[model samples]
Target: MDILLSAIFSSEEEEQYVLDCMAYLMLLMAAWTFFCLLSTNVPYGRYAMYGHGFPVNAKFAWCVQELPAFLVPVGLLVWTSAAKTSLLTNQLIIAMYLFHYAQRSLVYPLLIRGGKPTPFMSFALATLFCLYNGFMQIRYLSHYAQYPADWITRPCFITGSALWFLGLLVNLHSDHILRNLRKPGETGYKIPKGGMFEYVSGANFLGEITEWVGFAVASQSVHSAAFAVFTIVILRSRAVGHHKWYLAKFEDYPKTRKALIPFLY
Candidate 1:
């Protein structure tokens, strides 16, 4: 697809224009999604229902929906003639993006223990987002992004990279806690404890939001910033929804736990 796009666009500027348009589209999506999720939950995980769309195996849905985010960027690196894949800054940032998706698409699904089926509509939307975002991010990095040779040594890069790694650890640990919440053959939800879950209902979402925001800071680009905004919008809603659900369902739920952010939220 990158190869085909390279052939179709006669000038580099035209290709960048298209990428910019996609960035704008992502922002619009973030706004729309924010308003929509304000009144209703996304039909997935505990909120999933048959009425949302056809049901798909949860593991299969995760793998299929997430794979393109990892793959498309790689294809862009390998096939796109316009890409500056050799740049160290681009490579590092792209690798960070790939790392998260690799876990989501490949590792996370395999570890699932009898997760509920995902609605096909939710699955399809997730898949579409991965493709769209993956392409836009990598395309910009490999082709348009420019940084000094000392970029890796810079303060913003160092701080952002640290934050990204910290977020990844929190996200992974939170996921592990959630997955282990139930023993084998056990059913129904349990309040997740330890790590970030003690403080926020959406530990996983908080970790991801932190990661993208860190990525945006390090990359210092509108494209990455747009992704961070979209992530925050969607994950914030999900976190709030989860927090509300937990409170309503459990008589002894933690009263002090926030939704996405700790304390202030």
Candidate 2:
């Protein structure tokens, strides 16, 4: 019995050590990405610089790049021996992460009215990030996370949950406004109005940033915090890029709209 208990504790410790390492790596990645993005635009979407690689269909690229974020967690839940579902808090947190990816990977791509082709380099990078972050988050929650019985009732959890849902609504509504911006056969860009777009040029990016921040706050884990920081680093740059593009593209662009934040950038 003593030997068996020692083995079990050793395994648990090893898992935890791995989780810590991965989380730290993600933090390092966030720093590196921030510096890299300072001088260069993110190599996809509206600011795509296509010389690095071939272009892929935007819808297909979205599905392929984002699928691993949803699928990897499902795979971990099935294969891991940890008591992931035994804790209600774990279940809820995992559900929230999965829910976001399910919509992003499966539904959002189909809903895109006319997305531009993504560069192969950008698609590959995004695919790699999805795999890494998906594993980091789900592995921590399903195997390493624990919470008090009243965790769900706590102020932090409540506030984070509210923020998460609000961000999701904003994100979905912003996407809706963007998809409807141009007529079916239209090709050029148009000013996105309504929803949070009235306040920020990158409403969708703001929503996504809010989402991961909420996830970090609710989970209260280093792993989730790393992910949130990375999300903010990347998306904030994206929002700024979009704002600049809009300003340069159209003389009539809204002068009052900020980049990522509302009423302030």
Candidate 3:
């Protein structure tokens, strides 16, 4: 166990490591995301019928959409290390990954109650992916400690940090609102009315994307930028799908609202 942990955490550098690593990570994440979308049933659509008691199709969109979410970070870790960037970037990336995993793996599952059985195959594959990512991210961050002392005071950093905090607040609050809307043993869709929902259908996803985009800008790394771009691609697609679903389902749904963006799409 100790050896496995060490291997996951340790970083070995080669020339152009950062760029290469980021590229590979992005590719892997993109691939995995695509597979998830293709292989498993669409949770939202499936839940609408079995879990939420709404009628929806269970079609899998193109597999490409899945790749960006996971691959980007994986690629970033590899490329950043190879490029010999500062440990600060590595630490930040790792922290973000772990933080994200905690939410997706730990908190998300808990929020879900007894409903349609989540397919074991899908659950197993997703769990493995999350575990692998969690280890890699935490390991890299643990080894990374030093940062530019003035990073927090810099304008870019300040702005980025503010965006990150805002995103976090929106994501958390949006999730809270959704969870509260559904009572125990109740199965049906409920419009999230408060918080960022007033502006966008997938406000939670938008918040998460914004958070990472801020991180990338604050760190000023190509690796981070790549991750941000990939995130935007995947989440935007999901947001668009979600927006259409909302419009079709709710007659009183806000017509003026965008998909992922707040005011303008």
Candidate 4:
């Protein structure tokens, strides 16, 4: 497969074709996200909540769907080309991505005490996203991207990694708050508190957007940038929905808090 393709096409030719695929995919994602923002609500978790479809266990769905993002890169390293040209910077970037997914797919799912069932449709969509992004990021960084030997020591890399780490902490903490909001045998909505929740209605989303932005800054590739842009657009819209939902659901919901930021939306 990869071996045959590598033999068939020159390095430059393959890189260009793969990049074009990534760009097209990103464009479609952007268009779909825009449509989602304008015409439709998010189809999962509390926004649309329950819907028509075969339901899957939420923990199972999270583990299985998100596993691709965690496993695909390792598969690439094992089954496909092993880093077209090894660079510490590229490895570091991939490591950061895998670190997040490892926790998300493995740790997060098992920690779920009780959660609403997910529609098969929503699970399928999330699975597709994981596969797409997993392949794109790992493929580009491991094979196509050409980072400098000293790139890791660069200011942008250092800053971006710091931001990414900070965002990861924020996201994990926010999610923990939400997960514990309900006690055993309780199935009800409660306001998420602690960490960045004081500032934003969607602190988890804010952290995710921040992480992706940092990825773009560090990688400095169209692949990473596209993902970042798409994440921000979609999550910001979701944040807006969450903010509105909280206000409507609870009269005492803070009026001072913004959707995804402290002072400004």
Candidate 5:
């Protein structure tokens, strides 16, 4: 029995050590991503730069890259005893994370309307990101996160949940508008006019930023905050690029529309 107990304790210690190292690595990844995106945009689809490797099916790339976020977390939760679903706070937090990935990985790809191929390098990097972040987030929540039983009733959680819901709605609506922008056999891009598009040139990007901001607020963890910052850095820059592209392409592109934020650049 002593030998068994020692082995169990040792295993637990090793698990924790691995997770702690991953947390720091995630932080490093965020910084690296920020720097790369700062210097050059994320290479995918039309924005993809040279030397991004060969092309892959856009839908396949998206699904494979994104699935790790949804699957890895759940696998960790089920296979490990670190995070239990019995806690209301944990349940709610995990649910929110899973919801976003469920849509992104499973639902969103099916809705893509003739998207251009994704670069292999872009797909590989995205896959690495989702897997790294998925494990880091779930490990933090299950093993390290601490919250009171009544934490869900707090103002932060309440406001964050509301914001997340609103962002989800706006994001889905904006995507629908974008998908319908071009009908069958029509190739040209049109200005997305409805929903949040009227206020921001990149409504989808804004929605994702809002979602992560709310996520960070709700989690109140440095890890979540890092993820949120990373999201903003990448998406905000992409939005700015798209805004410029639109202006260069269209003579009547909205002059008042901001890149990602509404009423403010």
Candidate 6:
């Protein structure tokens, strides 16, 4: 009887230990991600554009900022896999991280075209947010954070995927509209007038916020929820600023459109 009791207690202890370790690792990853985000933003601010024509100062800044952003994600990936030895979790994280990287590294840079560069501060802040999010997402994925096996079924996954994809499309389209609003040698900003833009002045920001919210719901993780909250706080501020800027700049700009949300904001 005594031996049986000892075995039971030991098993419980081991399980709890594993859970505690996982929690600690998740927190560590989140912290590193935050640091990388701040570091990345500092350099992103210096660059005039996405491509090679950036000034020397901007180039140096980019070099400095890029390191931690790359390192944090890579380190988390390696550590989580080693700790859990879970290939499925590793694959999920890598796939999601790659998807985001494709958008940031390839799509965003291509979209720059000949328009005036985004404000240095804007780029810096945005990059920081992106890096922070990127790390959080990858860490969660690597941990296989999910609802109970039966909680979410195929149908739910399908619906959630649709929402996520739609949000991404809206975000990309809104960004394109804003980028193309200015041609070479044109300086002033214009009110974006397409897609969700008709509904909200900060349609791009709204789209992105929606995108991550959808992701968090789909993923069903506290880490993802935290990321969504942070995104909302930052983007909401930007949207308000943009709303005020538009109102101040153009007399003809519609008063009906909200800063971020459509209709009910």
Point to the candidate with the largest TM-score: 1
Clashing pairs in 1: 84-142
Q: How many angstroms is residue 168 displaced in model 3 relative to the true structure, after the best TM-score fit?
A: 1.1
In the range 10-105, model 2's lDDT, one tens digit per residue, is: 777886887789999999999999999999888887778789599999999999999999998898787666576789989988988999999999
| Candidates ranked, most accurate by lDDT first | 1, 2, 4, 5, 6, 3
Q: What is the lDDT of candidate 4?
A: 0.84
lDDT of each: 0.91, 0.89, 0.59, 0.84, 0.83, 0.60
Model 1 alpha-carbon drift over 4 Å, by segment: 1-3
Poorly placed runs, candidate 2 (over 4 Å): 1-10
lDDT of 1 by residue, 1-265 (tens): 6557858888889988998889988999999999999899989988997897899999999999999999998787777675567888888998899999999999999999998999999999999999999999988998899999999999999998988998999999999999999988889999999999989999999999999999998999889989999999989989999999999999999999999889978
TM-score of each: 0.97, 0.95, 0.66, 0.92, 0.91, 0.65
Model 5 steric clash pairs: none
For model 6, name the residue pairs that clash. none
Between the candidate structures 4 and 6, which one is better when assessed by lDDT?
4
C-alpha RMSD in Å of predicted model 5 compared with the true structure: 3.2
Worst 10 residues of 4 by lDDT: 43-52
Off by over 4 Å in 3: 1-11, 15-19, 22-97, 115-147
Error of 4 at 184 (Å): 2.4
Candidates 2 and 4, the one with greater lDDT: 2
Question: Per-residue lDDT for 190 in model 2?
Answer: 91
Error of 2 at 23 (Å): 0.9
Task: List CA RMSD, all candidates.
Answer: 1.2, 3.4, 7.8, 2.1, 3.2, 9.1
